[model samples]
Target: MVSLTSPAEAERRPYGPRHRWVVLAVGVGAQGSFAAMFSGIPVTGITMRADYHLSTGALGLVLSCLGLGVAASDIVWGLLTDRYGDRRVLLTGLTATGALLALMAAAVTPGDGAGVVLLAICLAIAGALGGSVNGASGRAIMTWFAEGERGLAMSIRQTAIPAGGAVGVALLPWLAQASGFRAVYAVPAALCLAAAAATWRWLHEPAPAATATASATASATASTTATASAGATAGAKEAAPDATAGASPDIRQKSPLRRWDVWRLALAGGLLTVPQFAVLSFTAIFLHDVKGEGAALASVTVLIAQIGGGAARIWTGRRTDRGGDRRTYLRGIGALAGIVMAAAAVLTDAPTPLTVAALALGGLLANSWHGVAYTEIAAMSGPARAGTALGLLGTALFAVGFLTPLLIPVVIAHASWTAVWAIAAAACLLAIPLAPAAIRAR
Candidate 1:
């Protein structure tokens, strides 16, 4: 019931409530641009293999390089975001990523005599740069939004992955078929540049006094109330530390890198991503090669799944914002995703319509949990360390992302597509136990 915003500080504030929405928009653009590159590129996998004369494993390796780069650089970027702030990190990373993509378009072509190794190197570098987007954008959302609406805000930002992927899957394969892979790279390059320009034009930090007062009030309210609102409870738990150290300083003062709860959340998120990445990286291959579906249909299925996933994320975010328990919701999602993926694995040889339905459902369920998990992570670590916490989680997710593609081919070679889906289902089920339990109201 205590008010954090003083009348004087409210009068001094430059941005209005609408400005946070603008910041969210900019974050979506920055994140979606990179998502288009990583998630969308795989839609061109079949064409890429044929054009480059690549083996399936080789194609997997090339795709995995992007994940490798992102995983390697995410923590470092998080550290930099904490130190240097979001605007600088987003602008530098987006511009550099766009330029790298442009270079790839110009030089790393089938006709230009470039090999897979060169292509892999370019993708890795682009991924490393693009890795800056996640932590920086996420930290911005945590800073700008109050605890009550943070779930919805973070979920909206997280939807950019599927939204960008939808764009990529819809456009890239067609471009690859009509204009060649050069055009494929060129499109995302332009997007990155555009996103960079937008970031520069908008995306400023909130007033420090507003943030400080909110923290102090939330911390005080948390200590006094036996049963507070979800927003206040979360705020109290994650609020910034006071200047004077008490017998036990707030957990916010501890580095996210060293925290067990942060690690659990990161590991749970990484495990959950297995099925999502499986769908993202190989559903086209599964549908076309295994089910005898047309390439166009396969691409359309992926596009639909992405759009559906994006919608699910938004709904879940809003639902959680209305006082639903985030950790419980996350576990429920994991269970449903596992069930869906397991069904897909079991029905691998069913009729085409049924098979497609299973795969689509699996993708939808797998993609739905990201926003909730990310919101929980940021809330646990507090806004001050959000970048580092998010970066650690990104590293885990991308490391799995990198490994998923590379391992899928090996699984397919020895076993079958059923085995791959089954493993993915298992990973999803495993994640439920690892999701960090909700913090009790102290």
Candidate 2:
């Protein structure tokens, strides 16, 4: 039997020099795969709506259906990652996702409500399988990276979302026009398969120190020190590597989901991401319907938003590392997100450049918090239960991911697009006042 590292053992063995980076790279690529496939409907919303004769609200339901599936499956995937490790979970998920995407391509029929429903079901399955990527990839990164670099590392991993969104927004329209929406699905499927192969070859669990090595290390314990100390997202953990370095052989029972701090972070995170998802879901439609931009051009603005969001993630991620109050930083960003989203929503009738500016800033600020949030979870929970905590957080956050698209259209129909964005802005601002535990969990 291939003995995997217990969580304690994972703590003892320092991550390999180059292997960690390779893991991060492969993991980010897989992240892109997840984002691309789930966001496919919205990215190609224009063509899909026309083909299927979907009303705005109906389209929202179809797009959000996939995220609903992701929300449902997120925790399950997290648990699997904790038990089976990131490699097995991610590889299996991505590979299955590829096959599902192909089935979606072959199965969906244009202009049929039943066809849309069928496509939605396929997407939901694909989303669930793809949901495997987030928590597992995060746990792997937490295990391999020390504290000093974790924010930046997680930031890069987080980029997979916006980066993939950008690719879908920029390319999928052309692909849809050229070959049909089926071709668009084919791209993600191919990418998933390729990512699966890369993951198999490159990803490895942090090796557990054998008994002999542990014994030897005890004698020379003073000679080594970790750059990152032990901690949890909301829980206050001491910085002693020796304290829990040889934890129980089974670490699955130490779940972080029960902690209030974890739940707080999860809830706040879910709410804060609403505007970002809203923008991603509606920008193409809004611009096409309101801004008079063609499909490709309208997509250009959202594509730029993704680019800006990625850059902001990298910047803020690096900044979040030198932290006095990670939770406060999160809070501040949440408030800022609300302000920007509301402004962007109202910018519909403003000058084109100004409208684009609001969207860009909204994208940058609204979506940039993942690295910081994930870092806090890993720091607080340690590698032992990071998967579960991250997974729990993902479940909460993506629930909004599932709902925002579905709800946005209702607001648009009852009020206006401005009202839709204003509501998203309020969601972020509302999260600000309910303070979670600070950098150190009590």
Candidate 3:
């Protein structure tokens, strides 16, 4: 039950607790930029349709290619981050993502079939490279922040997704409108390259401190058994396996996928993400196509939704850090999401001001639990295996990203947008019960 702090922990840590703001800043930038680029395809769907004369189904395929690329390669990236360290993996991945995005921009040519295929290939490749940020930056922040404060830190870090979505909403539309689709891609590409440079300068590898990982339930079970001893109760209570779990190699030597807790958390995270993906990838299209809003109005609506979600993420993370059952918090979030989305589905009309408010609320509640869920995942696995764990989780999540759009159209074809949204709501509600199982297993 005894724990030892690494002497080089300070040196290996990317930032001390006081300087932890640095990790927060870098995490947001790296994640935000990657989120922007990765989610930009759907955001730019209208522009691409005009530029390439493509259909909705075709656009879905293009976006699916990118998601497929991320899902297929996330495990590799996660392993690399754990093996080579966050800083190196993040820098390399971010640099390559920017460069590949630029190449995709160049490959674009209006009305050229071959060029469309080429662009999809480039986007797929870029997505594979961009995925490194998830595992790397996630591990970095987890390494820097302690568990008591990590909820806020990770929530702030997770805000990058919506923050990046907001960035994409703001920049991609304006650039596409002003210059061309090419300019839209170039902007995020430039931001990513610059972010990589900043990351190189600021972030450090927490290799020494990183030895504290793998939150095994066996150790906690041992602690609980010892809790009966009066003198050892406090020590027993404090003894989570995170203090004793070995480094990345030790983690890698074991099978992450074999861990039932990891599988539970991963599945929960993946299922919870369906609603978020619906918000991120379909908001603009839904508003434009179903609500009869103009492109500008649709874009702004989606942008507002993303901004709201981002703010909610930070606030939710901070409160969760203070104390309480995080799984309960996530369950509440999922329930709220279900109610909101189901109401929207039944209303069948988005013309009123109230509909806008509901949409925004839906977006906020749909996305808010992300940070809390991540905190649970990190606690279950610790920093050493977080990347690999996240990778396994991300594959399930992004596969939804790839398939959801394609499936939405099919539902709309057979039923209505109401059906599609109701399906998303169902996914959210299902996540509620999944959380308790994940928690119990942990």
Candidate 4:
């Protein structure tokens, strides 16, 4: 009979170079999926006006519904990933979301209200499916990488969201220009399906330890590292140690809700999202309606925000990894951006170019905190509970997400776009003072 070995030996077995690519692909695919999920924002008003003849308020509800779905699924998917391995959950999700997007393309015809409802349902489905990508990818990276490099690696993975959004905003509009929204969904859908298939075929779990069968000739002392190395699979019988034993000294088990740091980060994250989402939800419309810019120009402006946001995430992530008070840095950025957003709100009627520039700068600074927040979450939760921590954080953020888009239209109807941005700025500012307390707790 064959003997089983320790888990410690198993982790030492390194993958081939090709396997590294598989890991990277999973990270990128996860980020890109989220990017595609949010692509609906820019085109929402245009679609509503063109098809179903809905008012801005109605379209806002639909947009908010999408966020509701994402928020609703965050906890479910996070727990699922923790129970099941990240690979299976992530692959299944990508496939299901892609199918829903394709279904959306087929269901919604131009100017069809029934189609609009169906499309909203499809969007909700896709958002739920997309929820798994972030937590799963974060956990996967934690599992695969050593402690030293996790920050840079995770930041790169996180970069996919903004990069994918940039791609969607930049490319989807052009695709719609040539064809239509129906055709537009095809691109992201196809990408998701292809990535899903690739993940399933290529991904492998951490290998099991080598086994050592007892033989009459074998001696315990003789079974040294060199001896085990010479004999094929001789070390399989050794049981693995806990992966976390040597990583950090401060490993503690705490309830997610009990952790003040988690709540602070989540709240701060949610507040920061207000201004970002406001701009994302309304930038295109503001450009089209207020600035009298064409669809192409509006698309460009959205793309700029996405690209800038994406790059900022990576840069801040690396910076946090290097050494700084992540909470302080994040809070400072949030506060500063809030001030800028408040200024932008007041200057909304300024020259078109100046207004766009202000929005872009505000978006960049506001979103720059993502990598820092994500990195801190992973650190705070430790590797084992990373999924849960990320899930909880996402749930809180998306809960706030559910309100921002719809709130924008209501604010715009009664007040002005300036009022909406001002309120969002205030929301960001609310988090500034709380951040210091959070850092102390951490």
**Candidate with best TM-score:** 1
In terms of lDDT, the best-performing candidate is 1
Q: Please report the TM-score between candidate 1 and the true structure.
A: 0.90
lDDT of 1 by residue, 205-299 (tens): 77766565544543444455415565644534433243111214556678988888789989989999998888888887888788777668778
Encode model 4's per-residue lDDT on 1-442: one tens digit a residue. Answer: 0112233543565654335446867778766866765764455456555555667777777777667777889877777777776777778778887887787677664633354466667667777887777787777766665333455567778778777877777777667656776777778888788777766655445442211111111223333422445321222121111122123434436645567767778877888888777777678778888888877666666667778877877777655444344666778888888998998898899998888887877876766777677766766776677778778777877777778987888889899989987998898899887663432211
The lDDT per prediction is: 0.83, 0.74, 0.70, 0.68
Question: Which regions of candidate 1 fall more than 4 Å away from where they truly are?
Answer: 1-13, 209-248, 440-442
Cand. 2 Cα-lDDT: 0.74
Clashing pairs in 2: 231-379, 231-380, 232-379, 232-380, 232-381, 233-380, 234-441, 235-441, 236-441
From the highest lDDT down, the ranking of the candidates is: 1, 2, 3, 4
lDDT of 3 by residue, 264-362 (tens): 767777777776677666666677787766567656766777778878888877665444456667788888888988886776575645665666677
Worst 10 residues of 1 by lDDT: 238-247
Q: Between the candidate structures 2 and 3, which one is better when assessed by lDDT?
A: 2
Off by over 4 Å in 2: 1-15, 109-114, 209-254, 435-437, 440-442
For model 4 the local lDDT of residue 343 reads 87
